[model samples]
Target chain A: MSIASHALWVACLGLPALAADRIEGPGLGSPVSAQSVAARNTSIYPDGRGLPEGRGSAGDGRLVYQQKCASCHGERGEGGSGGHLVGRGPLTGSDADKAVGNYWPSATTLFAFTRRAMPMDAPGSLSADDTYAVTAFLLYLNGIVGADEALDARSLPAVRMPNRDGFVWIDAVQPEKPR
Target chain B: MPPVNPSCRAIARCVQSGGAVRAFSVVLDCADTMISPDTQREHSAAVAAQEALSMERWSRSRLNADDQAPVAGGGLLDRRLFLKRGLVFSGAGALAWSSGAAGADQAALPSLRVPGRGFSNYGQPSEQEKRAIRWISANRAVPGNGVSWSPLHALEGIITPSGLHFERHHNGVPDIRIDAHRLLIHGMVERALTFSLADLARYPMRSQMLFVECGGNSNSGWNKEPLQSRAGYLHGLASCSEWAGVPLAVVLDEAGIDPAAKWLIAEGADAAAIHISIPLKKAMDDCMLALYQNGERIRPENGYPLRLIVPGWEGILSIKWLQRLEVAAEPVMARNETAKYTELLPSGKSRMFTFVMDAKSVITSPSPGDTLRSHGLYEVRGLAWSGRGRIRRVDVSADAGKTWAPAQLQEPVLPMCFTRFRIPWNWRGETAVLKSRAIDESGYVQPERDKLVAERGRNGYFHYNAIAAWQVDEDGEVTHVYR
Candidate 1:
């Protein structure tokens, strides 16, 4: 018999075949508690969804940036060891020159990335306020906002990135879509 | 697996130390003693002739016309004489040394007297093959965030040994206890569910040979100058293995994905908590929660208990130490997808989520760091692959791109897996350049270096899949060059 027909025959014999059209057999696992997901699943999307209530100004952020990020990102955010936080145009350049100011396409990414993973050494340690402060400081260094401008859940999403419209969602274009 | 015998180790050492002829002769002599006199007489003359042929001086440049004959396809070599095909064992012609001394005086060999040790629970490559290891390039400052390259040039066959599979870890590999680990599926799902490793194992499974390649693989090609390194080091960030797992779609269906869930935000348990957004369609199609690789439990460095395997997608999207997958309406804009992996297109705009790796091929043997010992005939062997689909053809050029020759594709060239292609070429002491370009089933040709550079520019350094060229000096030294 042909392989396809043999597979069909096997399926008919009540024997488990390789990959089913849909799920078969008893569904595995148990329902998870909503609290557990709420506690750990802390990811923020681009449209300001899942953001916590907090506020910080660029001036207030300078202190946090100095204490927590300066060691790696440089005191002035010019970048010493870790990636640069300030630069302009041509996101592609020397490793030190591809700063957040130039390359990053979304401002919300800064707040999300900072809140989730930042400080290089002690990630997930920053408070929501501290994360906002750092995000404001980075934006200030990029000249995206004034030093006194306050950034919060309502204000952060409105910040425009220099390269915000520069990106191309490659999945939607060119070569015939995924089969 | 049983303990490997010390004698077996000794035999391996003997074979590895250019004493294969002597070791094989001793083994044959021992066999001769056990066989009856009539049988020995029947094979004695044939064995003697084989031994004589083995001891005969041979040149690397010499090739039998019958074996090197060109086939019907453009520049394609005859497939009958492929060294990897139709492996057969003959008594007299035993221990075939494809191209090496066959016979030597076998007087002193310890393995002849001592019986080897028993097997062990797990096996390892013989001590002599220790050279086959992942070339690690980790950061001294960060320690764990780095990459290890698979030694592709040293390996044979299409399947890369699980131990030697390339690695690109963001945070040091997490020591996740299988029993303690639980994968949480929540967010836009109708029901939030957490499954233990055992629970996932209860589901139906499928195994397929697929390749996982880091998005940054072959970035060295973007360097202003071509890098001089082994073929594996330059492009070894990709590896192929047989992964066995439960289709992710089934698990998602169990969770009942919300129609609004357009993306799946996968997070790892690593210190970095590396997370990225994968399209919901891709997740529901052909993606799997891989629990095993190469017929065994996945290696610790390669996502121990569970990993999300998105076939043909960037390796990073195949998150290791998978902890939670949150269905979302859009991308998380994670650091990996923004500051890194994203490319700065020459159009002055950045390109994000350029997920699929394009068609590419590399001549593994006679590559940089390999020297042509003699001017005789050599089989130009290499691997060709395309994230889009199976490689339809791999055209190899011996004298740069002036002329092209088709290579014989090995059987079972599955989609998105490494297809070993080879063509025999005769070198006559001339300084020749070698190149191979892969054409996938979609008719997408691997771009040339100049064409790629002209389009992408040298400022960006990701997803570089241009044709690689190796130059052979008159003295037989091979090195990398951007032609």
Candidate 2:
């Protein structure tokens, strides 16, 4: 059956018997503009594109972390209700607390996470500057960056995580049999 | 009538004359309570007069019964004993009422008869079964950013009643108006296309029974001490249903996915605006754009109107309130992927995108909070499933992990749906531990607790499928403990 007819049938099942409604008419009364929605979801590639235009310093991040994040995350990023942000020790074999400095595989992930859903209460409330500052503070807490070092999209991706070389990809070559 | 004992004779005489005698006054007392005050005297007299007649008949019946008596289990009686329907009197002085006169007496009692009410558009379960509800464990500060466990123990049958399905909300559920909802396909597509709910509904549809499990389920197992909870409370974040919708492949084809597109960023329309990056290969392979669940439109708690149903993956990736699908060259590495769903490892590395829920099984009955109640022959029942494939066998060990026996799996074990398993267990008095392990069709046997810890490290939190143990004491109390 045509996709249109199938959709019509589902609609008939979901709603009271109404006459066939045309798919076209004022963009089906959608609230948001198609162009704006598309623009909002810019693609962030692994090789590094779609990074937002902003920069921040670890020294600046210290002020931002104290003002916005320290209440739940603790002063030294030891973690409280929110999780610990700093690494405990080495990033090789077992016995590591694998937090910011040690565990995270990519610095891009840290930037995306903080930008989208951090600070718990007021998510997306922070400006790009504030997000970069917070990211820098977390990196500094994990001992990845100097206290005064600035972080931007280009520089952020280059900051190698301590545990970067520790991981071994699932050996698909000889798939492990179920035990 | 035959001569009665002297004690009975005195009481019978008092009763026959309607005298105020307490002993041997059963007939008179019954008549007094049943009849009105004005007719009580007459009723008592009538019953008293009938008692002498009944006594004469009883003597004749005794003679007839004595003459026709046979040995035990004789006179049309078989050697096999039949279960009795009515109450059995075991104590002395207990009376057994026969059908004819006893039934008539019972029917004469006053009773109120009222007709009950009728049907509704939507039906609720019986009022007595209201305890079957999702136990909400939401974040106190956030309105709806927590998990609610499906009450699996309270439910019977495979399908989780739509109302009580477990919920894991990152943000509060949004009341999105269906008429206003539209899905925009953009990014690395040849042609950017936007489809309304009406337009999407027009696509060819397919239905399959599948389960969605949250990746971080059973994280409590990572704790130093074994957490005490009903099996469902700990692992109830997963549920199975018959999801029907358009194949996502068709949509991707229509949008003309660019050859360079490797990842698809799926975004939701909630206040959190949750987004996640999914590989293009998986999305085009078995993923479904689900509109209906279990033969009905999806419940609001589950993505109403539309959702992406990715088979054999964690529930979070199945974005609800689907607003847009942006094809891309690489993963967005959203917050869920980076910080939240990622698990910190002891080796100073984090495990990201750990999607599949491995094979796991737990004995539902005779579990914690239930007593064995002098166990003799008891049924051990549990649920088992695997995201990789269908469950092949479930081995239940009653003596901890020492000995194992094959369990009976219910038929039609569809891939990725809950398959119920049962086995007959005869329990002796000694304290014992019970464990069940599921082996999927892919030859993946569930890992033991110690083995899991060794492989995944103590600090790892997600995808915990360690064999769970329930210790049964001599007192018949079952408790969760590591054996």
Candidate 3:
């Protein structure tokens, strides 16, 4: 018997055959709850979409930074074992210290990064308010924000960074090089 | 996983006391030995001669007349040599067997004198091969935050043993429990969903042999001076494996992906919680939630329970220890993408999200730190790969691109996987500069170091895929050079 004819016969006989035009896959995933996703959905977007309700000033952040992030990041964010969080330098030079104010194009990144992966040894341990406070302190250290400015979900993303227009996306239309 | 005693500082070291460096001495205990004193010297010499002669002759005879002829200036044999035709092994084997019989003492080894050691549940490499290891280059204060390079110089063929696969960890490796782990595919979808390991197994699964290379794999190549280290340390931040898992598109399709979701914010569960942004278009094309490596469960360091295998892209795109994948419209512009992975050009503008690894090749056999032993005839072996596609050709030059030779591409050279290439060369004790350039199916050629550096500028450290040059000194030592 021909393979196609055999498959047809098998289908006529009510035997299961591979579906050719079926686009939707074998649904196996279980629907996740809001509470469960909230626990893992710590992704903070560039437009400050995932920022939670939190408020802190540089003064509030100084205590949090010294207590939790100082051992590795040094006393004043000048950097030690951890990378320098303060100071701005040329991106092309040998000593391009990619501190908070100089390199990062978005202010929301500081909150997201610090909230998700800061303190080196202990990550995601800081409270939302503490994380916002630390973000403010680091921004202040890099001269992006004032020492007493209270940063929250509303005001954090609004703060313009020094190197906001520093980065350029891949321009494919331009002439190609060896890179 | 088999126990790898990596803590041993000095591997393959012999205990030398009172000027005695011999491994096996003439044993007076004849009752426990296989050979007696009278014929020991004769037996030893005969054995050595028979073994060496047979090997040289047998290897030489395997080649047909067409294979014997050199295709290029460096005595490069035809790539067709790999596709050996006709029944020629018996003739060579007969000759080898007769020669060995003449020196009958060449038969049994000391190991065959007694029963061998029992089997292991998971077998490790021979104790004598302990020299092979991933060379760790971690920071003193933060050991786990650095990379341990795969010892590509000490290995052969294509597939890097899973244990020795290169590791580039932003933070330390996280100990994730299989039962507790969940892959949440949420955000910008019609219905948010999370799949457990068991749930994922029910979906259609397939495996592909792909390479995962760090964007910073050859970052050192950006330096003014070529690094003087093993070929692995210089370019070992990449690794290949038969990654088996469900297609990522299947899961996304089940979740009913939103049309506006153009990006994926992949976050790992490690201490770094490494947040990375990948294009949604690429994710749907050929990404996989890799559950297995080399037919076994993935190693903990290489992302055990679940990881994304972004084919033909940088290793960082393949998020290890994956926890949450948030579908979105824009990139997260995380630390890695902004502060680190971005390249600073001469124009003072930094280039971001440059993903594809370009075509590149390195002669692994006679690479740096390898001393070409007598150097009459040698197989110039190396690995060539292109993240864009399969390598179309790899031309080797022994005299600094003055003369070129085509190498035999080992069979089953899959796309985005390491394609092993080899060519026979006759080195007449002359100082030579060795070079290998890869041309991918996409027609992308590996650029020279000078051309690459000149175009990339001094500060662009990531995505370096330049042709590697190895200088063969007259003394038989090989070192890296920028030619």
RMSD of each: 13.7, 20.9, 11.7
lDDT of 3: 0.74
Q: lDDT (CA) for every model shown?
A: 0.74, 0.66, 0.74
Q: Please provide TM-scores computed only on chain A for all of the candidate models, following their numbering.
A: 0.78, 0.70, 0.78
Can you tell me which runs of candidate 1 are displaced by over 4 Å? A1-19, A91-97, A173-179, B1-62, B65-102
**B69-174 in candidate 2: lDDT tens per residue?**
2212111111111122442332221322343465557756554254567779987888766445565554333445666767665555567777777777776787
Across residues A40-142, which tens digit of lDDT does each residue of candidate 3 receive? 7887766678899989999999999999987766788865445557767776655344567777888888888888887667777999999999999999988
lDDT of 1 by residue, B1-483 (tens): 311112222222232332211111222212222233333333333222211221111232345433455543223355445474553433322433342333342435567778999989998889766556776654333446567778777666789999989988765788999999999999898899989999999888999899899888887777655655568867899999999999898888888889977889999988778899899999987899999999999999999999999888888899999999999777778878877777776667767798898988888876776666665556778998889989999988877787787788988899999999888766667788889999999999999999998888765557889999988778767778888
Give the per-residue lDDT digits (tens) of candidate 3, residues B4-61: 2221111111111111111111011110122223233343333223222112432333
Candidate 3 at residue B378, lDDT?
A: 66
Worst 10 residues of 2 chain A by lDDT: A170-179
RMSD (CA, angstroms), candidate 3: 11.7
> Candidate 3, TM-score vs. the true structure?
0.83
Candidate 3 residues lying further than 4 Å off, grouped into runs, are: A1-24, A93-97, A171-179, B1-105
Grade the docking of candidate 1. acceptable
Q: What's the true lDDT of residue A24 in model 1?
A: 51
